[model samples]
Target chain A: MNAFRAVAVAMLLLGMQGGGVPAVAAPANAVDKPVRIDIRNFAFAPATLTVPAGTRVVWTNRDDEPHLITSAGKQFDASRALDTGDTYAVTFAKPGTYAYYCSIHPMMVGTIIVQ
Target chain B: MRDANDSTNERRRHFLGCMAWAGAGTLWLMKGGVLQAQPLGGADAASAADASFSFVQISDSHIGFHKEPNPDVAATLRASLNMINAQSTRPDFLLHTGDLTHLSRPEEFDTLGQLMSEARSGKVFYVPGEHDVIGDNGAEFFRRFGERQQAGGWYSFDHRGVHLVGLINVLNLQAGGLGSLGAEQLAWLKNDLAGRSADTPLVVFAHMPLWPLYPPWGWGTDDSAEAMSYLRRFGSVSVLNGHIHQIQQKVEGNITFYTARSTAYPQPAPGQAPAPGPLKEVPPGSLHRYLGIRDVRHVQGRQALAVTEEVLS
Candidate 1:
């Protein structure tokens, strides 16, 4: 999951400043590091999140049961059933409010807002 | 050597402890539901091996799934087919309750198709579980296996005086993720059963439990009571389902409701764990004990249906 966040941040940095790998943190701190979403008790912790554009979020399954991270819209592929200890990462590139649920257990729902 | 065996025994004890905590009185329901004054389980009646016709029932294949508990679902499914093939009298057909694929991926369907092709049964019938319809209202699944069902992916067929109906209750999941068979399916079921003789033997198959096995985990269907109401008049009724991934049986009146174990993996018994997914970290070689197939034999003259299970291992 951290590697995915690093790659996502790397892409954002490459797009911001051409021809350079900047070691120093700047505006990247907020958008680069991921926000954690823990899936436990058949729900997404902090069922909602508001992060800046280019921000990446990582959902880790902490429950004994399997869960999924699926966007309600066609924004992303519904995640495969995630066994305990499995992690799924999704990055919000554009600015918009996206809603999602565990397709397996439709009762579960969460939201992500990017600005 | 004694030390290793001792640790294994401890682990089994721990697992059984967790199971008992999850299921208290309900554990007895596994076999005792037949005595609940609804249907005659007829469990006491000796199940006759000889039958004029028979069919095999399997559920929750969950192909394309790669996770703990059972990573090689295809292989387990093959194991099931091997059992089917080895049956001395080849079953006239096979009934797949639902959840054919995990994420409903094309490759999963491809794999399920290939493994099923190896079955010695005459034909395989399917009813969609919620997982099978995950992405696009089951268009992909229907496109591949939906031709025979007249409409709504639910159909009824007849074999040797037995009327079999396959219903779809997972199309629209209800509260608590309970399976639902919309009005259309219920009306069709009502009309479908019309005019049939009361003595005609009946077998109904669906993806979710038609009777509310456990509501908290969506183990039961919402409006199946109405659907089941249509069949009370029949002399014999057997409702088969999957999705719980464990065997639980109930007999209410002439209606017998049974849920099959999954070939993929076992889930915590209903309401056992926080929520139902897969039960993992089982003792070695114990997984097969939780997986198996149900074979139904229909003899021309018999008070009790020969409904029996054979474990995958």
Candidate 2:
């Protein structure tokens, strides 16, 4: 009985330790970072991008006219007009492919792939 | 006695001819209100038909733009409407070939809507420019004007023996600043034009140049060849686009392509400047002079349409 109890205790401890490892490891995968984007003259500077989940993407309008970062069929929208030198940023929390454009200039488009 | 009467009659006939020529010139100048050069070769041949239906093309209104080049877009748009209203024959409707608002704001759309209401011609047809659909794939524009179209804001209507197609190329833009017609829209376009007879006059309106205008600034459409292929069967194909913000014309096969000037501001000609942006301050009052509207007339049995671009001075 004594040996069995010791074995059971060891098993429980191993299970607990195994469960804690992923709990601690999960956050390492969720490293949140910020990204920068520039909007200018009818095009997005970095036309394509890949970032981790919880990344923040900032877009600066370097053109003389106003611009917006809006996505199709998604809630992501920086609809506020970004004038010359104006800046707008959004932190993407979910992991998926995101395509966005300057609501003002549909031709001005960019994509963000969150993994 | 007979010689005197004959000379008098001859002088009277000559005077009448002179008066008729002056009257025709005056009417032409009035119709060609802005500084746009006269229609290019074959433009008159296209206008030989007396189809009598007229439509207005208003491009690059660049609202919310406040700068030296064109500080007052609203005023220029107003002037464009005034000119449209003043036409000897009012247009059946207005087709705004992209760039309806500079900022794509709710308020900007509202301002544009309000200003456009003053237009004597009712029923405005709109498509997204790269600027107009930047933020939300044109959520605000779609919310307000999308219903006018059927397929993601591209639709077709027939009026007075003419088929008008409003297309969406600004949605998926290419790297060269070329507009795109995506596979879906391309299929739809093929189906749309499939049944129409070759004699049908087809007027295709979009934001970017269907024919190569200037690729460096992203002024042209990358998939325009596919679009043009679908249109090739038609005897009279008129492609009206507006991203260049200047008046330019090109003829390919049976298609006549034209680019309209911006009602708000003027960008430097392709490759003329270091990069494309609202041109730095022009001489005061010169900006509005560049803004104008295009008047297209389709005459029956003619292979071309009379396209006249008049700018606001």
Could you give the interface RMSD of candidate 1 in angstroms?
Answer: 3.6
Model 2, range B175-274, lDDT digits (tens) per residue?
Answer: 2246788888888899999998887878888988887787766667778998999988777677888877665677676777777767766666676554
**Per-prediction DockQ, in order?**
0.24, 0.15
Candidate 2: TM-score?
0.67
- How would you encode candidate 1's per-residue C-alpha lDDT over A1-115 as one tens digit per residue? 3445566776787878785665544443556778889988777898989887887899998975556777877687677767679998888899998888776666677989888
lDDT of 1 by residue, B186-274 (tens): 88899989989987878888888898898766677778889888998876777888888776777676777777767777776666555
> Which candidate leads in lDDT?
1
> Where in model 1 is the C-alpha error above 4 Å?
A1-35, A47-100, A109-115, B1-14, B17-50, B174-177, B285-313
Error of 1 at A84 (Å): 6.6
Which has the greatest DockQ?
1
lDDT of 1 at B203: 83
Q: Per-prediction RMSD in angstroms?
A: 9.0, 17.9
